[model samples]
Structures are given as C-alpha cells and as structure tokens.
Target: METTFKDFYDTLIENLECYAGEYESFIDYGPKLFKVLCDLLNSDVDKSLRLVISAAIGYYVTPVDVIPEQTYGPYGYIDDIYLSSHVLKMVADVHGYGFIAKISSPDIEEIIIECEVKSLEILSDEEIESILAYIGL
Candidate 1:
C-alpha cells in the first residue's frame, strides 16, 4: 500500500478502538457512511474514486454480508470500520480530506467519526480479506 493508505489505516484503526460500542452507533454510522458515499459518488472526483466510493457504499448495504451482522451483534460493525477506512483511503488519495467536508448528510460526517472511534479494533488482515472476498469487492 502507498504511504497515504498506511497513514489512513493507522489513523482509522486508532480511532476505531475508541468508538466500538457506543449507543446507536450502528444505525447512526451506517447511513452516514452511505451519505458520504453518495456525496463522493456525485462529486467531481475521478472515475476511479467514484467506483471505490460506490463499492464501499454497496458493501454497507449488501444483505449477504461478510461477517453477518446479526451473528456478531454490535461487533458486526467492525466490517463497517473497514469499509469506512477503505473509502477514507480512496478519498484521501484522490482529493485529500477536504471533500469529506462537502458531504450533505445531516450527521454522517460526525457519525463516521464516531464509527471510527468505536468500531471493532481487533480485526485481522486475513479476516478482513475474507470479508472482501465474500463481498466480491
């Protein structure tokens, strides 16, 4: 991965640890994630960034999920953190962090920050890879 990707990953991971099980976190963050996705997808960013942002949003809504949200209970959001991290890397790589501020969702940006702070922090590379493969992203 590129340096920017690494930095985003590290930052997100640290933040995720802090937000893992807050109240309403799942419902709050999920829509916020998709809202940001909508903002990015509709932005003037390059086609590649649009595709990545779309994939991340798609991953969020897919019913046949990788980790099966019901099975993991609240912890299911770990995958959410990963997807958010993926979007952040793509956004930072193509447009830095400024575009994140352009999202129109009422609380999506704050929700994303909360998601990062509280998302599952112990996911393994192999586990995440399994999810990506399961989702075919």
Candidate 2:
C-alpha cells in the first residue's frame, strides 16, 4: 500500500519526539505545522499554494534533508520547521492569519512567526537556501 500523509505525519512525530535536542521547543511545533499543511490541503485554497504546502510536507518527512533527524536528531527538524513556517507565511500573505487560524489554532500564526525568526537565528541565509534547493522547493 502507498504511504499516506497521515503515515508520514505519524512517523515524523515519533522521530521528532525521540530526536528533538537543543531545538526541542522549536521542534515541538513540527506536528502543528504538519497539521496546518493537512488542513490547508483539505481547504479551498488554490492549487499552487497546495503544491507548495505539499513540498514542505515532503521535506519534513524525508530523512535525507539538509539536517536529517536521522543524523542530527531533534536538531534535524530545524529546517523542516522553518520551511513549514515559510510556506504558511506565504499562505497567510494571501489569505490572512485569520483564515489560517480558522483551520489551525488561534496561536498558529504566532508559532509560525516565532519559528521563522528562531530558525533564522540558527541557520544562515545560505543554509536556508541550500535546504530549499535540496528539495527543489
């Protein structure tokens, strides 16, 4: 059988719980971001945004990412979290935080904003660019 998004989400969450290290707090939002992507996929958003959201989800589930949790543990989720917030920011730009808040949590916007800032603090622009390029996102 083909692996569904739920299967990926469950596996990612399990890995995150075991590997979340110094960035544990930031990594904690990994599940929430995955949930937001799932919610967006089910929402009435346009096709392009859904594609980008899907890419972000793919990046999160892949073990061979820029910072693989398989290698770096919880620290590996930094890039995944960053990409999620980045994609969510793009959606919010189009539909507004209120729109996302309806599908996700009331504090999701805040969480995304914080994750973006914190991720930047850890990874440089070059590193973030490489991560994006790694997945062709």
Candidate 3:
C-alpha cells in the first residue's frame, strides 16, 4: 500500500524513539533517507521548489528543532510534515497535480496526530523556545 505523509512522519518519530538506544541505527538509516530526499530535489523540478524542499529536509534532519522531541514526544512529527509537504508541493509544481496521490493508512495518520497533540500538551514554553532557537527560528 502507498504510504501517506502522516505515515512517514509517524515512522520517523517512532524510529527516533531509538535515539538513545539505537543511535547507530538512526545514523545508518539517516543517510539513505537523505539520499532519497536529495534525489527528489534533483529531479526535473524547478530550482526554487527544489531549494525549498532541500532546506526543509535539512531542517528536518538537523538535531536542532522548532519542537524538540525530548520535550514534545511525537509532535516533533511536524518537522516531517514540513518536509513532506514541501516535497509534494515541488513534485506537483514540476510534474503536475495528482503527484503523490497515494495516501497512507488512517491508523498511521491517527498515531501521528495523537503523538503531535500529546507532545504539544506536554512541552513547556521554555522548552519550545529553546527548540525554536536550536532550529534558528
């Protein structure tokens, strides 16, 4: 089945839960994902759109964040949304509409939404500010 942006986001967050225990795994997986994202950016897409997607991916992978995962649980998934939407938008802009037509399962979407909502509730203002600073916002 085709995965939706939400599904991908949840997977990224769930994988991140291993940041402490499976640091090596995260490190290993990151390069491969980064390559795929890079390929998407280098496709026949417009340069401006590609640049935006590249920037979003860079921001998503960076340890710095607008919402730190340590404080926000899965709401950190927002970073994934930011990245994926930019990619999808670029694809549509260059390839045409109906690009990225595959939607992820509803279950995955719910998990991502739940995690984001819970994280938002648990994270403090100070922590959020720190995260934003880390992300250079």
Per-residue lDDT of candidate 2, residues 1-137 (tens digit): 99756576677677766653677777888888988898899998778798888898888778698888778777778898899998999999999999899998899888999999999999988989998887676
Q: Put down candidate 1 lDDT per residue, 1-137, tens digits, no spaces.
A: 65544433243344344554544445345544655666676678777677667677667656457665557654665676667766665676677556676654444455565565554355677777776675455
Model 2 steric clash pairs: 19-74, 20-74
Best-to-worst order by TM-score is: 2, 1, 3
Better of 1 and 3 by TM-score: 1
- How high a TM-score does candidate 1 get? 0.63
Off by over 4 Å in 1: 1-28, 104-120, 134-137
- In model 2, the runs with Cα more than 4 Å from the true position are 1-6, 18-20
TM-score of each: 0.63, 0.87, 0.44
Across residues 28-82, which tens digit of lDDT does each residue of candidate 3 receive?
Answer: 2332334445555545556656666566576666665665555655445444443
Best by lDDT: 2
> How high is the lDDT of residue 125 in model 2?
86
lDDT of 2 at 78: 86
